[model samples]
Target: MDDSKEAESQLNEKLYETRMKFANLWESCNPVRFKQKYGESLKITRDRCIEIYEEEKQMCDKVEITKKNIAEQNALIKKMQEDLQIANQKFESNNKQKQEMLKKIKQLKEELAKKQELISTQKQENKAKLKELNTSAEMFKKRMGLEIRRVHGEQLQFIFKCINSKNPEQLFTFLLRFNEEGNYEVMSCDPPLECMPLLQEKLKETNNLSAFLANVRKAFAALV
Candidate 1:
């Protein structure tokens, strides 16, 4: 606007100068004075026009440079905006992933707790079943009536070393039945009976007579 105003003012000034020269020429019939005065006026107006032209040219150059700078800045701003949008999208995606992972962790924790509860319930059920199994085993053994017999006298004087077995269900049913018939001494292997439970537990670890008898002997030695 300023450049346009300046150009307009220069053009108006030129038009005014031309009108004044024509008026002066019309008033003065003397061509000599007209030439001299008009020549100076023309020089001054030409110099003014040249000055205005230079100013206008400089302003045009400034406007072009400013336009170019504004264009570059706008392009840079657009690129920055695009980058920011992309970054925001990435951040949102990552945040969503983190939330999903947390949800998964929560689900896993709940499942683990449920599994632990199930295991505890199963253990309780197993205990009850084991108790029933033991009771049934005792009843079965009584019905079967398997008893140890015939194999010991002066020919095999044995010193029985065994756990201070109290569970009638757990006791060697064969030995008990024969003890009644044979009248064998049934003493606890231990002197204080402190290690008898451990002895029984050890014996229960195995199935064979060799291992069972070996643990009994170890209990006897421990008592001594």
Candidate 2:
């Protein structure tokens, strides 16, 4: 009966030791104690995640601004192209107007030259006509002078013949000529007669050939 009590006591001591070990493991693995030990590391990780999110948002904003700038530049380029086209059209129109004005000026200059040439031609024609009229007048004056001299010569010859017929016994002959002054002059008489000297003097004073001939014929008839 004593041996049986010693074995039972030993078994109870072992069971107590096992229960104590389980209790120590449970205390070491508690959820609240683990959180307390690692809380600083978890907070550092969360802050790093917030920094990356902010960087990504800033990059997105910069990309949006760049897109807006590109769109504005394109609009400005289109407006400049339209303005250049308008300026080119204006230049072409101005050039065309200038050419038309130059053409008109050339035509006007040609017309003026033609008018000047026509006036010059008319002046030459008028000068020729005036010269022709002056020549004709000179010719008419010379012809009329010759005719008057011829008529006076014939009248003198007839008068001398009549006077010779009247004076049969005393035949009279005279010399007649034109002097330097284009007048008739009695040079001399063949026989000296009383009327011859007086006839020459009267002819010098009066310059009338017909009257002198008539007076000389009357004086010769009276002497006969």
Candidate 3:
């Protein structure tokens, strides 16, 4: 009976030691204790996740703003391009009008030059004709023994005296005038001779002053 009691006591001690080791290990690995120890680390991890999410959200907002700004800029660029096109069209139209005006001015200058040239030629021709008329008048005065006097602005008087002839006492006087059409006509004769009508008719037909004077001399001699 004594030996069995001692053995039982030894067994109790061993079992107590085993139970103590198990309790110590359980305390070290307890779920509650583990959570308490790592609680601060878990909170730090969660805060980092939140910060990353906020940063991502801010990035998304910035991207949206940037996209909106790009769209507005594109619209402005398109408007500016359209305005430039309209300006170019107006410039081209104005340039065309300017060119046409220049062409018309050149044409007017050419026409004016031609008219000036024609006027100069006509003036020279008129001067030549006036000189010829003066020469003819000088020859007629010397050859026909004719004396002329200005009757009015448009009329002349001519007197012819018969000399070295059978009718030396005879005198021929006539008035010459220009008609409205610038033609010469005999207006009146001093003698009122019967041949005056025939002389006037011939003068109207021929317009020859030399022939008229010769015929007048013959008529005067025949009368003598």
Candidate 4:
């Protein structure tokens, strides 16, 4: 391709040189004066005139051909330049669009990262709250059990005091009523106790409340 361009340049230079030579030949020729001086020798002058005319005509034809070629080449060069300019503009536009897309993608990734961090933080907070609630519930259960045991101890002391008192039968009757109140009904203790069973037999046989009370106290001691 470089060789072809070099050849074309050399051809253009030669054509220009030839055209300039023809122009100089026309400028130096004094046609009217030559005719006036050579009219007496008309035959010689007429032949010379015809030869010069043919030369001028051939030069003009060559110049016209060169001009036509130059015009066509100029038109082609203008079109090529325009095409190159359009291509460059398109390339710049595509590059600008690519840069914008990259920026948007980077922004989206940053937002996603922030959202993921927030979700992880929320999960950790929820776990901590659940642990705290479980700890509080355990403490409440222990406190409730302790309170029930303490109240049961007080009731047991009172029953022990009335175990062999005067009018023991009347005391037993009162104790039976007290047991029915359900205050000492501790289902979660190490061992369970019920006062109603102890008095049931005695009350049926001889209405002997003292014996029932004594028997219940003994059973109570063994259970504890």
Candidate 5:
């Protein structure tokens, strides 16, 4: 019975040792140990926050730079638009001037064409009058020895008719009055001696029949 009591005592001692080991293991899971392990996690979280802040600041700086660049580009575009507007206005002004000059040139061309037509008509009339004069001269030559005064009178009448075709009453009246007086009237006639100096000066400038016809037309229009 004493040996049995000795064995129970040994078992009780082993159970006491096992309980002490379990108690030590449970104490390792306390708040002091958990705080030591989680302190490093708090430091890691602080570093991550600083890194994110730095990244966000860089992004904001890039956005500001981009905004400034966009503003500069917009200013440049506005300046170019203004320059284009000014250039367009200048071009329009120049084109308007060119159009006005062209209009004036067209008017001058029309005037020149009218003057040429008047010159052509006068040429035809003068040519017909010259042919009539030549025919009358031939007729006068054929009757030179017979009725000289009558043929001379007819020639003078032919000359009167030729001048009357152009100057109508002006030249015909002067020629008829000169025939009656047998001498030219200086101050009293329609085309008096006063016109001779002006005609002499005009002939010095242009000795052509075209200029003479222009002068004759002007005189006739003035008489009208």
Candidate 6:
């Protein structure tokens, strides 16, 4: 009976020691659950980082669109400036041409006025020359009438030359006449032989001897 009691006591003591070792192992393994929870938190942080990156990409695309619009507006403004410069040059050239045409017209008008003035001066000079010619013809006619009677005989031949050179109107109006025994006479006292040719010329030109002789004695009667 004592041997049987001793064996049961040893078995109970071994069971107590095994139970203590199992409790120590369970205590050390409990911290492994906390490490697993930290891993799940890291996965959530990675998801938030991806969301921020997508928002930044959208902002960059909007800036590129605004820059393209500005470039198009600048090209249109440059073309308009070039067109304005060309138009101004054309207008200046046209104005210069108009001024030259007006200057030429004024010069032509001045030349025409000078020519008209010269013509008027020449016409006045011609009128004075014609008036002097008429006065000289009258003086010559009076001289021819006096000399024929003063120089008698053959000297009367010189008076014939004066009558031929004188105007036709002078010779017909200034000849002398006389009356002898109530009969009309002409060129007798002046040695009338030299006067025959001059008198014959007058009759040949007129074709009216009686009428021409009458016109000479009508104005004056001189003894010759």
Cα deviation of 179 in candidate 6 (Å)? 60
Write down the worst ten-residue block by lDDT for model 5.
176-185
User: Per model, how many backbone clashes are there?
Assistant: 0, 0, 0, 0, 0, 2
| lDDT by candidate, in order shown | 0.57, 0.60, 0.74, 0.54, 0.56, 0.48
Write down the worst ten-residue block by lDDT for model 2: 143-152
For model 4, how does the per-residue alpha-carbon lDDT over 45-123 read when each residue is reduced to its tens digit?
Answer: 7889999999999999999999999999999999999999999999999999999999999999999998788766755
Query: Evaluated with TM-score, which candidate comes out highest?
Result: 3
Model 3: which ten-residue window has the lowest total lDDT?
125-134
Give lDDT: candidate 5, residue 23. 80
Which parts of model 1 are misplaced by more than 4 Å? 1-27, 125-224
Candidate 5 residue lDDT tens string, 89-201 = 99999999999999999999999999788777766655564554455446533432111112333222212222334544334222211222122111232444345456545
Model 5 deviation from native, Cα RMSD in Å: 13.9
Model 1: per-residue Cα lDDT over 1-224, one tens digit each: 99999999999999999999998778686788778889999999999999999999999999999999999999999999999999999999999999999999999999999988877776665555345434544443354322222244311112332233442232332221112222222333323345545544553444233444444445444443
Segments in model 5 whose C-alpha atoms lie over 4 Å from true places: 1-38, 125-224
Please give the lDDT score for candidate 5.
Answer: 0.56
Q: Which of the two, 1 or 6, has more lDDT?
A: 1
For candidate 2, write residues 14-118 as lDDT tens digits.
Answer: 777877777766665777766765676677777888888898899889889989998999999999999989999999999999999999999999999987787
TM-score of each: 0.44, 0.39, 0.45, 0.37, 0.43, 0.29
lDDT of 3: 0.74
The alpha-carbon deviation from the true structure for residue 61 of candidate 1, after best TM-score superposition, in angstroms, is 1.8
Question: How much lDDT does candidate 6 score?
Answer: 0.48
Could you tell which candidate, 3 or 5, scores higher by TM-score? 3
When superposed on Cα atoms, how far off is each prediction in RMSD? Answer: 18.8, 24.2, 12.0, 27.5, 13.9, 23.1
The total number of steric clashes, by the backbone 3 Å criterion, in model 1 comes to: 0
Per-residue CA lDDT of model 3 for 1-224, tens digit only, reads 99999999999999999999999888768998778768977999899999999999999999999999999999999999999999999999999999999999999999999878866665565445334434545765687566667677646676766533766556777787656444457788876568977887797788666677668656655665
